[model samples]
Target chain A: MDEAAIDVRGLSKSFGGRTVVNSIDIRVPKGRIFGFLGPNGSGKTTTIRMLCGLLTPDGGEGTCLGMDFRTQAEKIKEKVGYMTQKFSFWEDLTIRENLEFVANVFCMNRVSERVEKALKGLGLESRADQLAGALSGGWKQRLALAACILHEPEILLLDEPTAGVDPKARREFWDELYRLSEAGLTVLVSTHYMDEAERCHEIVYIAYGDLMAKGSVEEVIAKTKLKTFRVGGKNAAKVREALEGNPAVATTALFGEDLHVSGTDGEALKRLIAPQASENGLSLDEVPTSLEDAFIYYMNRAKEN
Target chain B: MFSRQRIKGLIKKEFIQLKRDRPTLVMIVMIPVVQLLLFGYAVNTDPKYLPASVILRDDTFLTRSIVSALERSEYFRIAGAVFSDNAGDARLRSGKDMFVITFPDGFTADVVRGKAPSVLIEADASDPTSVSGALGALQGIAESVIAKELKGPLADLAAVRPPFSFTVQKKYNPEGFTRYNIVPGLIGMVLIFTGVMMTAMALTRERERGTMENLLSMPARPFEIMVGKICPFIFIGFFQSGVILFLARFLFGIPVLGSGGVLAAALLLFITCNLLLGYLISTAAKNQTQALQMSIFVLLPSLMLTGFMFPFYGMPEWAQYLGSCIPLTYFLRIVRAVMLKGAGFADVAPNFWSLTAFVAIITLITMKAYKKTLD
Candidate 1:
């Protein structure tokens, strides 16, 4: 991380007396894909909007692309691309027309060439004449990405860009993102998918209005301090039930015949579940805490606080 | 295949959704209440106090009695006296007076000698229905007043061929066709329909479809977006205006008497005013449905109070003031004056300026209402 592309502090936003994002600080280095993860209404979208100048923070100070995000919003808007969670493009316009409209809005030079390049780059050239509304969810997401990058923005702020896409399409979308990132574009993307989050260089997890966790994928899991054990047995539900009542277990889930139990204190959780595992003639194996489990631990801890 | 429980659940859901839409709920209650008040309080078919300007070359007792009797009849208000017949004609052309009653010179001596002098009564008959009732009342008023004045000797004079004669000349529309008045005013109506209602729904559709958020997130300024959105509708409004003007000219045979440039300029100003007002409505409305409801709310007043359907001066003073505040009122005036009286730019300049002011005011308010941020 040589220099921060997006460096923000005390970024807070509220809607109608309800605080959506509060005092959230984020710093993403240039040319890095920073994942923003949160449950629904966790202010992931709110924070992104504030950074892009689509929303003014109730209380905050930050810089996006080295310009004051608040006061220099117009100038910053020139360099930053924002993709909303919804398909917020003109559906009536064809794919080519939509791109052309966006290119015109940005007042880009050589708009036709730029549009043709974006269409081909997004694999939309074959169906560029189709109305945007007629496209499937996966293709719509791709088109949104193409439109966002049409102006050659330095930073891309995507709010859940792949929320409803098929797995294959999502994989392709991420491949495009990687290409953009490698080409020196800093990306701040919000998503609910854990697999997508793991692909990011670093991630920040927000719960409700607070920043719960922030680090690289492994570092975030390490920060959670959660220990997980895989118990394989026919009595997996029984094992899960017993661990659910105990404070030592942060989260417990049954994956087929195997039960995965996790908690912050490794010693206490092992001590608590070891007897139960042997009593039921179950094999227990310690496993690294997955990001999903770490996130659940953060959520549970936030709820308790 | 419809289950009772499912139907009941759907009905409940619909009601809940409707209740949650506060703007629609408010519109539901306000539309009828306001409509009732407007129809009951403001609308009048047989308009009273039709302003009449007079040029009395014979201001004798008989002529004065005739003028006072016209006022007492309550059909005419007797606005003010003018020195010449040209001034009276000017008042009629400008729509300031509905009638111009002129008493010729030496009318008292001629009447006493049973000369049966001619009294010229010029009526602005562009809006035939509005002036018809007052015009019908004039002869009775003058004859009765003259009969009262020519008492002893005039009883004999009244006995034969009437004491005096008055010729009622209907100006602008000698044929007195109602279509002439309505067809010209239809230009403003069609403009309102497209410019206000359609423009409002178009903007709200963008917001509802979520395209507006995307547009706002771009490098586009609010003013640029507003202009781009409204410019297409402006063309649509002009197209509708052209259609109406074509129909008015061919179908209704309503003469396009004014300069084409003047009418086009007025149409541009009027259409822009309506489109800006629509933008203002869209800024206030949360969705397309609310935008439509608000458009109807604004439209009903323009239709009723702008002298489009009803006589403007016939409404109560407060309603007249309210009507004046609507751009359609000035538009109707300008269009009618231009089409019927062949008025020039100077004739309709006040109305053109009023519409311009409306555009300016609505533009400022819409700018304030339009939030650059989603907040």
Candidate 2:
């Protein structure tokens, strides 16, 4: 096992007396893409900010890039490349100018060459002289990524990097992240997209300021202990309506033409679906529990408590 | 230790953005020129052509000569003639005339007999500045005109000077050119405008644009950021002051009598103080609008109470005390003393130290207010 790149305990933050990030712990090994999965305002952004030293946690003790996260935040900042949730670079400046400014701030040697390399690496060489504000959302995200990694820090903390970005751009962005991770850079990205979350080596789910789940995609789904019964028929919606109120059913979601009913108690789920299975023109089949279903089940359970 | 390279980088970035922002750049230069021209032509302490009505009871040549002489003095423009004292007072009260000159019913025989007839002059003194210079000129005009009128047989009366005589010599501004007073004070005004407003918006703009979080997440220190943000505007302040000073010297013919080194030193200190005060405002403001409001909030009091608009010593003791607290008040004194009064470094040392203290205090407060982390 490798040493954890980010190891923190009991991290919490509150804004105006309302806890935005409760006491949560996380540990991610080096060279892994860790995805932060949660609903909006679920402390994903706040936790990412805290981990990268952009924000001070009200209560937390941790190490980032092998330095004390609280007292040695500046030291940690030097080793971490943090890309904000918004396009935070100077919009009026050209792409080359923005990258050059970032490189200069880090006081890197051979700044022009480094900026040129970053521009070329991000496929922004053609638009190097274009103003950042003039770029489309996809181009802006690419430019932001290029600027953040100019110093080549050992850790990358990205806050919703692909938001509002097209699917093609997002796929290309993930491909770049994978390349960075393969080069021994630890990556922690906060995102709401399930596909993006699934691309991560490990994932942590948070809700209402609490850590609901944490593990690999398979491990997280297995831990949910959810048995999902896919119901397909002319009256699949009717089957969803029948099984919704049962104590065995945690969540019932319609996924285009099919209904996925899931619950934690497998025996109860099976017993409830058996009667539905015997109904005319109705068929029930057990399917592999997906990350989305497990997440929904966890979200519903958290809401219930 | 602060990173000089990072500070340089920040300044470079600022200049590039400033080049791109054409409107703000235009404002930076145009505001001072517009203010200079506006205040230069519009503000005059020595008001002329004030409306006056004369009440003549004697209808003597002497009264007519006095009225015409008053008109020729350019201080009084005869609006009309009033028949009674009541009408004269009505004209004064109704804002129709600024002054009422009344000649008593005593005939010209009194002046011919060397009895020294008294002519009463009533002036509206509501706005003291508008009336002060004209009123002061009345005594000289009366003496000269009466002396000239008493010729030949009245030459003895002309020879007899007034019971008490006094001469007023305006040493620095002999002609009472308001530009001489306003142009130097404008340096302070322009500095405050650019220094406070520009620096006030710098950090808040970053925060509003979401770049502040990225800035803080880097390895830069607060001191470095503060210096970087403020250093570029120091040049801007100098650029504005340079334009104003050039105009003051070449265009307005106002002299810079003090040592150039001392004036530059004072200006440097004053500009830094205002820029730091602006930075302090930025740390407290959440956005650019609030920052601009805060800058204006500071500007209003400084402009009103700093003796830039009115005489500093003429203000009440408490207002003077309040004015003394504003950096612009001291800077106005320093710049005016240097440029207008021909003051030396030693003469303006107290104000120099006061501005330095202001810079120190504001820098400390700004640093304390600028938190490294988002709380």
Candidate 3:
């Protein structure tokens, strides 16, 4: 954590008299891609909104890039580039024109030169004259990012930048993010993809307006404290049905040909699954808990709370 | 309040966006000129040509002479002179022609006996203002011609019809010229055209596609954004105002009775108020469609309630009270009062204060609402 580029505590937000983001704390270091992961309505965007100084938290004190968020919002704004979930750009304007418009907003010196540099940076030189609306989803995203970074902000806040892109395209985007991070731009990105989460330097999982876990991807999976077992047989479906609703069973998910199950009390889970395994002639063995399993376990726990 | 550099950046950005939309800019200027022409030429209060039917019940020489004279007069056109002895009076109730002249069955014998012949002029009172003037003016010509004819026949004419009177004072425009009134009010419309079309598209655009968050996070304050958004419109608005004034003076030859400097100052205030109002609408709308619709809804009501079509003086008591609340109504009134009535600054001081307060209050509200962004 290099000087805690984003250090915040007890952040809370409310709208229409209901708390959307409750008391939460997050600390992100410089030059790292921090992934905010959670289900829909889990306050990931709201928390991101607060951290970037795009919004003021009702109850929080934080510094973004070593500036006080409440008082120095203008200063923080000058340093951060935020990519929203939605595609927002003038559809009528060409790619070059859109970049120029953003540059105008920043009032940067030598605007035409900066436009050339941004066009080259995003690999948008070939299509600079094309209308923004004519481009497909990936290109629109590239344009939005180019607009955000034209002023060369120190940090970038991406709210689900790769939501609908294909996996290959998503990989290409992450590569660009890694390159930007290596150049000393702190990144705070939110995504639900497990593999994408693993690529992050650290992960913060939030659910139901509460911060559930924060650590490296491997550490988060280990901290779930779940003992999982995999049952594979021709009658795995029947085994899943019988094991479900059992007090000892925490989760039962169909994974291709096998039924994966988990429970916090390992002894009780073993006792329950052993009988079902023998009756169905299914082979049972302890399995390494994947991130998806840990996520599901944590999500179900959040629901019961 | 914001830093000087940040405010400058916002202003520059706003100008760039404004330069992008051209069709809307054309519409703003077009609506005002079209409205001015529609109101100026189409709206005529003076009676130009009234259709008057004469039902001559008398077949005497004097009645024939009176009928011939009424036909030749410019005040009324003789549509049809039906013999009262032929068709019944049922046609009179159908409102065919404004006035009917019915002379009694005197024959020319009453004039020879030196007794004055009495003729009845029944006028249609449906639209009392329009036909009443024609009725009053026609009677003057008929009476003067009859008095001359009677003066030769009778020596003492003391008891003769005491000269039917025509008392008409055409207020505002004695010549009934269109350019006089329309040119003054067109100035206000031009301001609205330029100010509203520019500022209305600004904030909603950012919010519609999710770029507003990025802007809010920028080093720009809400008031700074607002000022930036309106500055470009103000310049355009003033330029349009100048064009309208030039058209009025050079093309139409309309007199600038009021202080040109004072008129320009009032126009600035009007445009400022319009920009502020546009900003308020933008903040209220979630998208461009919503903003555009709401602007129309507001613009239409303002065009009506602001006394653009009907005169504030001629309208009923309730309408005049409603007209006073509309900003455009007050602005138009001040512009017209200054340009047409030659009203000084002291006369228009109240209107200036009202516009100043309206712009100030709306601008403050938008600024306060914009500053309250949430996590």
Candidate 4:
């Protein structure tokens, strides 16, 4: 087993008498791409911010890169690259200038060489002189990532790195993350996209200041113990709508033309859906619980608690 | 406590941004020029070339000499001669002339006989400061003229001081040009605006644009960030001081009597203090608009209580204490003393040290208060 890159216990934070992050423990192994999944306002960004020393956690005790996260933040900052959820590079600065600035901030030598390499790596050499504010969303994300890796940081804490990007751009961005991870860099990325979450080596789901689930994608799904059944018929929508009001059914989500109904109690869910299934004349096939179904199950379960 | 490389990067970035910001660049150059011209030609507290009329009932050589001296004194321009007291009084009442110089009958004879008759000079004393300097000049002119006329056998009478003949030797600004006071003080005002407003906006703009979080997450320390951000404006402050001093010298005839090195050193300290204050303000403000609003809290007290607009000593005791806390009050004193009074380093050492202490204290506070994290 690899050593943990970020191992913190009882991490907590609050703002203005409202708890944003409860006492949550997180541990990501070195050289792994750890996914942080949560709905909006679920403190995913806050947790990422705290890890990179952009914000001070209200309560926590642990080490990042073998140093105390609280007392040795400055040391941690030297080795950590934090890409904010927002495009936080200077908008008025050109792409090359922005990269150069980051290099200088890290006090790296051969600034022009490094900036040029970053520009080329981003495939933005032709547009190096363009202002960052003028770039499209995907290009801006690339610039931000390029800036983050300029210093060759050991750990990358990305907060929703591809939030507003198109799917193709997002795919390319995840590929870059995987490449960085393969190079032995620890990556802790927070995202809302199911495909993105499924690509992670492991994922943690947090909701309402609580860590609901944490494991590999399949492990998280199995932990939910949700028995999901897929049904496709003329009355699929009617069955989905009818199962939503049933207490036995945990969650119902429509994927394309098919409906996925999930529940923690397999027998009770089957018993409740069989009658509706017969009435709608739709055949039900047991299916593996997907990451989205597991997440929705966790979200609903968290809301109940 | 600071890294040279990070500071250099911050300074370079700031310079580029400052260059691109056209309005701020224009303000940087235009503030000193516009303020100097506005205050130089327009705002004069000491009114000169005031109109006056002579009521010469006992016209003699002494009286004529005194009247001519008054005209040459440039404090008053003789509008005309009046035969009756009513006409002179009416002229003063109507504001046609600022003063009515009345020579009582046998005034010269009484002086010659050593009877000590008084020359009645009635002045319109409304708006006292406007007339105070001219009235004071009148005393000097009248005494000298009488002494010149009372000669030979009358030398003894001249030797004896006249009834109102206590001389006030106005030092430094003998003419009491208001620009002499104002022009030097403008150096402090210009620096306060540029140093405080520009630097106050520096960090706030970064935070507002969401760049501050990324910047903080870098290896650069707050000290490096603060110093780097403020270093570029130090040159702007020097350029502004140069502009104001140049205009003060050639345009308004104000002297740069102190040592250039001493003035420069003192100015450097004052400018650093103001910039540090602005940096401190930036730490507290959240956006550009908030920075601007916060800067006014500093600039207003600087303008009003720092002896810029009103006399520093004239403020109430508590207000004076409040004024003393402001760095500009010391800077205004230092700049004025250095420019007008030819004060050397030793002469202005106290004020210079006050600004030094201000720099030290504010630097400590700002660095301590500067947030390394968003918390």
Q: For residues B1-375, write the lDDT of model 1, one tens digit per residue.
A: 889999999999999999898888898899899899999999988888889998999888888988889899888899989999778877788788889999999988898888888888898889998988887886788678866787775678877777787789999999998888898898999889778887787667888888878887888887887898789887888888888888787878887898889999998899888988888888888888889889998999999999999989788889999999999999998899999999888777888888989999999898888889877
Candidates ranked by lDDT, best first? 1, 4, 2, 3
Where does model 4 exceed 4 Å of error? Answer: B1-164
Task: For residues A106-204, write the lDDT of model 4, one tens digit per residue.
Answer: 999999998988888989999999999999999999999988988999999999999889999999998999999999999999988999999999999
What is candidate 4's lDDT per residue for B1-375, written digit by digit as tens? Answer: 899999999999999988987656665676577456434543345656677788888888877887888888877778889999878755654335657877778877888887777767676543244456677786778677866777788888866667323223334565656677778888989998889999999899899888888898898988899889989999999999999888888999887887788889988999999999999999987778767866876686677666677555334456667788999888776676667656667666777778989999999999888998888
Regarding TM-score, does 1 or 4 come out ahead?
A: 1
Q: What TM value does the first chain of each candidate achieve?
A: 0.97, 0.96, 0.95, 0.98
In order, the TM-score of chain B in each prediction is 0.95, 0.60, 0.57, 0.60
Query: Would you give me the overall lDDT of model 2?
Result: 0.82
Q: Candidates' interface RMSDs, in order?
A: 0.8, 0.8, 2.2, 0.8
- Pick out the ten consecutive residues of candidate 2 chain A with the lowest summed lDDT: A274-283
lDDT by candidate, in order shown: 0.88, 0.82, 0.74, 0.83
Judging by TM-score against the true structure, name the best candidate.
Answer: 1
Report how far residue B33 has shifted in candidate 4, in Å: 31
**Winning candidate number (DockQ):** 1
Candidate 4, CAPRI quality class derived from DockQ: medium
Candidate 3 chain B minimal-lDDT segment of 10 residues: B86-95
After TM-score superposition, the amount by which residue B199's alpha carbon in candidate 4 deviates from its true location, in angstroms, is: 1.3
How many angstroms is residue B46 displaced in model 2 relative to the true structure, after the best TM-score fit?
A: 13
